[model samples]
Target: MHTGDVTARLAELLLGARCPGCGAPGMGACAACAAGLRRMQPFGVGGLPDGLPPVTAAGAYADTLRAVLLAAKERNALGLLPLLGGRLAAAVARLVLDAGGIPSLVLVPVPSASAQVAARGVDLTTSIARTAAARLRSAGLAVEVLRGLVLARRPEDQAGLTRIQRLANRAGAFRAVGPPPSGPVVVVDDIVTTGATLAEAVRACEVGDRQVIGAAVVAATMRGGGAR
Candidate 1:
């Protein structure tokens, strides 16, 4: 069974079927929460971190979307993958179109530290990326997922850091392993608060002599903030 399947099953056994967005009783998402997710009509997100590429988001990081993402991150809400994965797939399509219709694509997930994976019992980024890739492939798009990037060094937790501090902490923090990604690449992550992490992923691809076409996120913090 997939790790997501195991996690979701465990959650159901321990806590019953509950909506990741509203905590109402249901599998994956309750009908109301499912209705809450949709593609942003204007998909482009502004104010990227320096050196970050043009990107798209499934939704702003607020409301029901915020609840769902945090559920997948903090709780074992893997049952919600179908919903979240759909959101990510829409974002990737928008990004590909913005990049002038890339012929084919590889999705590279930003790695979560081994410690985080151990503590959480799931790699949220990779799981979601694979889910999105599966959805894209079913739609007849050529999509692949590569998950070989690792953090070169550990940085302090980013919760309270200023934008500049985040950039400093993650600078040169990622490197690709097991040969580098080739063909057009799109870096995938669950969320983007300041884009520090995503920029580093792009840099890692550059270091490996690859260029990221753009990035796609399940959601992004839409509040105003500038990156240095």
Candidate 2:
């Protein structure tokens, strides 16, 4: 098993398998948080303010969800990514099904800057996408992970950047290493703040034999607030 699995099991044992966001002890998601998150309907984006693929987010980017996302992405709390990524993957899978049919899902994680991944001791989004792929496979879906894509530039952090600025910064920053494997490619990210990053990733993958299908993220900051 991967480190994510080990951490997830440990978290479940220590936290009573509770929803990390709301402190609902005893289940992966408590009724309240689940209801709230679910209420943040999976909205379609032409792309984030950035230029990523159409994104489907599990929840908004604040409050309980924010805490969970920070823990997973910033604090080296790897366990939460599986929980969060799995939810996003499920939502994405639904969209795939609704669109027509399920193609072999190839998870292409949006690459983080090498410096940031080095600081974190791992590629956060890649790891989360891997876990999500595993979960999707376990549910009897065909899936695989491809990290053949690489970054050609390191754009500045997008925290306060406007959508246009973010898009301009990320333009042409990604490049594919080789021909993509045969399947529908879905770019995965931990969060879709503006979407500049994800869009570039999708564009890079489209250069090869890959069919760009969609994108998914654990959370997205709503224009107004919260996920809903």
TM-score of each: 0.88, 0.78
Model 1 accuracy (lDDT, Cα): 0.80
Task: Please provide, for model 1 over 89-192, each residue's C-alpha lDDT reduced to its tens digit, 9 standing for 90 to 100.
Answer: 99998887777777689999899989879987888888889889998888888998987688998877888887788889998889888776567789888888
Could you list the CA RMSD of all candidates, in the order they appear? 5.2, 6.0
Residue pairs with backbone overlap in model 2: 50-194, 50-196, 51-199, 52-198, 52-199, 60-227
Task: After superposing candidate 2 on the true structure, give the runs of residues whose Cα lies further than 4 Å from its correct spot.
Answer: 1-20, 23-41, 46-53, 224-228
Q: What's the lDDT for candidate 2?
A: 0.71
RMSD of 2: 6.0
- lDDT of model 2 at position 61: 75
Q: Per-residue CA lDDT of candidate 2, range 11-48, in tens? A: 77886565657765443545576566556656565334
Instruction: State residue 146's C-alpha deviation in candidate 1, in Å.
Output: 0.6
